[model samples]
Target: MKLKKRIFTILALIAVAIGVGSVCNTPNTAQAKGVPTVFPKNMRGTWYQYYTDGVEKDLSKVKITKTTYILGEYTPKVIHKYIPHDKPDFERADWIFIPGYQKQRGITWLNVKQWNEPAGIGIPDTGDDGEDGGWGENGGEFFNVSKLKGHQVLSIANTIDGTSIHNTSHWYRSVKLAKKLNKRHYKGFLY
Candidate 1:
């Protein structure tokens, strides 16, 4: 009798442990195979550019499709005209788009330029500063880029302050695409 009772107790404990482990290991349904589903489809549109010091520039178009974002030039002039006088002039190059991940913002992007490569580009979401709570610093402001309608402000992150710090360098909004341009413009940046 004693042997049978001991075996029963051990079996019960093992079953309980397996149950708890399975519950803990369950995957989050909100994310698909680890990729988030919150990205907006209509993120394609023209957005105004602004600098960290509150300097605003001409409107630039942003074309976002299923997998990428193609950014247009802020001005028509050559790269040298726009860069600071002290900066070196590189060859005139066409725009290149690459996929990027912002763990802090929780939104992946097809980027024309590397995040923070240009002084005033990148998305900045809203929330407190730090990792102790609430998406830490970048977790809370996961804006639905696809849902951004025309004329609404899109806030950009300020890289100079620090990745842990959330600062606003630019605010942009969706505007009507020019008649000459088509939805194919969202495919990639044209020279």
Candidate 2:
């Protein structure tokens, strides 16, 4: 009986050691405190972006030039489950990540009508009341990421308005910018 008890104790210790080893080998995705794993200081600045050819359609009516806001230090992990307007019930979580950036994990619908896709109407640089437009083929929209020293500008030319429309999606970082937009921001997922 004593021998059996001793064997049991030895087995328990081995199990515990194995369990600890497995846990130690597990990878942690969360950022460590005080460690700048993402969004290094150099990344915070104003930037100007253009198409691959450094040219884009003229969108004067949309007026996206004056838009400035802060982007989150960490890239959000986004999970997209597209709900088609004209198809059977189907859902899928699209895992998206920016190469050499942070993870984005949220599903958001891009309203097409409010999008400045056409070439006549105008949209405010920041607000909730722009013409809605549909999402792109991948249910995503593209924005030019320009940096400007504590402020970032995302410019998208409104094909419909013949102007650049600023999407104030980052106004929540401060108070002054929020007041300018009447406390309303664009509805695009950051994380």
Candidate 3:
């Protein structure tokens, strides 16, 4: 009787341990604390306009399409070669372009810093101007994704010439052909 009771107790303990382990090992889909995955899936894609020699080729509307990660993050060497005056330690964000109004441009990493701030306001910058206090288009526009329901729109702040030209318009449309790109894979900018 003592031997049987001991065996039964051990089995019960083993079963409880197995059950607890399984529950603990379950995959968690909840957003991790520090991981930045809040960006919507519908917004990841390539937006472009037909341009020839830096000139608009036609008045046709702009188009956006999802593509495999192609564009690479600016390496230290590339950044130094092109934008030497700017700080090398910069994070990349999604590129927001408003055709005709604001040609193809990146949302600068500065927006990330602002967004991280406790009191940061508006959508982060999708364009980089390179150096600080320099005359270039570095400031990004603020976009409220929560307000945008099924409407693809980019609100761009006109950082050029210090003008307050805030242009917000609906994109022609969005096409998703390739896998959806996110910052998790690319680190800074979405491919």
Clashes of each: 1, 44, 10
Cα lDDT of model 3 overall?
0.32
Q: Against the true structure, what is each candidate's TM-score? A: 0.41, 0.25, 0.30
Task: Provide the global lDDT of candidate 1 against the true structure.
Answer: 0.36
Error of 1 at 75 (Å): 14
In Å, residue 57's CA in model 3 sits off its true spot by 15
For candidate 3, write residues 1-191 as lDDT tens digits: 99999999999999999999999987677423332222234544443222233443322232213321222233211111121223322342222222112223443311111221112223334568542321234343332222233444333232333343334322223323111211011111222
Q: How high is the CA lDDT of each candidate model?
A: 0.36, 0.32, 0.32
List clashing residue pairs in candidate 3.
92-188, 106-126, 106-127, 107-125, 107-126, 107-127, 108-126, 108-127, 123-142, 125-140
Error of 2 at 11 (Å): 1.7
lDDT of 2: 0.32
Over the stretch 19-111, how does candidate 1's per-residue lDDT look in tens digits?
Answer: 999988887774434533223444434454422223543455544444344457332221121232222223333222222235344433321
Candidate 1: worst-modelled 10 consecutive residues by lDDT? 182-191
- Rank the models by lDDT, top first: 1, 2, 3
Give the candidate order by descending TM-score: 1, 3, 2
